[model samples]
Target: MRSVIIATENLGKFREIKTLLADEFDVFHSLRDFEEKVPVDEDSMLYIENAMKKARKVGDRFGMYAIADDSGLEVEALGGRPGVRSSRYGRSDDERIERLLSELEGVPWEKREAVFRAYLAFYLPEKQRCYVFYGELKGIIGFERKGVGGFGFDPVFYVPEWNRYLAEMTLEEKNVLSHRGRAIRAFKDFHNVRFFRNPTVHRL
Candidate 1:
């Protein structure tokens, strides 16, 4: 199978990509699996810019196809604060949750809306082309964290339509609506359709 490198230090993110692309290619991690530790600046204000930077850096370094994702939580009540700084919203995960809850304190449920936004970039060094994909998950911020299944803001992100926090859903269930999962699905489907139309061009 053709190999594809995913540039990310987060194991959970790698696992999600693996699950999404298992049938299409041999997915590997750019840093963890290969012991590569080159740093790429993530100061870009936009998720696509950050994702493209990482993907291009890793793809050029390894001379292989590379994929990277930049995702964060955007809260309407907070004026879209912590959007690109989701990981560093606070000193720690617990602190981040606390801060989120504190920020929404006394805010009406109708106004405590938020969404998870993800941007995925694929770099093909051989083809000299980059493809970008986007996905989003809409939900409201809960007063308190709930469940223990997911990382980041999962516990505090409640999908009112589903009446449950993201952390309360199983991995499979979450993937169906997750920002990362949705992006990967779109990328995979696009590749599949393109390859199907041009059978002469081999693509994993």
Candidate 2:
């Protein structure tokens, strides 16, 4: 059985990635499982850079494969105000939502175009290689927070394809259309193929 680490302390994300990779991996571990935290500052301007930095740093520290991701909500009207700063915009989730709504208060529905973007990075220490995948869900920002199903900016992110706020969707539904899901699926597919010939290496 091979052990791989998910480079995040976030329980929500840890569970999602565990479920996504459960059937394929023998053992799963998150950064929270370790005694000492790996210090990897997510100060990068781009999501990919942050994701890669976290994964690579963790993998190097433990000599184990690591999976990490960076995601955020980008509003067209704000000129991508909270791209990499989605989690750092406000002190708390409620405060963040309030600030977002305040910023988009005068923006019309048509001008409220927004996108939820995610970038996933996988680091393999033995090979010193990294794989990256990207996904984005396009939609408009809702006038008010609508659902309670997801975390972060789910309540305020509207999905045109589903005709509702992401918070309104079920976990199964969100896993099918959300940015993280898309990125995970892409990485999963690539990993399945990439590891088809290499039996010992497990894909993160």
lDDT by residue for model 1 (45-95), tens: 988888888988899889888989899999999999899989888887789
The TM-score, computed over Cα atoms with residue i paired to residue i, of candidate 1 is 0.90
lDDT (tens digit, per residue) of candidate 2 on 22-128? 76688999887899988988998988889988998999999998889998988889999798899899987889999999998988989998888888888889988
RMSD of model 2 against the true structure: 3.9
**Shift of residue 191 alpha carbon in model 2, Å:** 2.3
For model 1, the run of ten residues with the poorest summed lDDT? 195-204
Residue pairs clashing in model 1 are: none
**Per-model TM-score versus the true fold:** 0.90, 0.91
Error of 2 at 180 (Å): 0.9
lDDT (CA) for every model shown? 0.83, 0.83
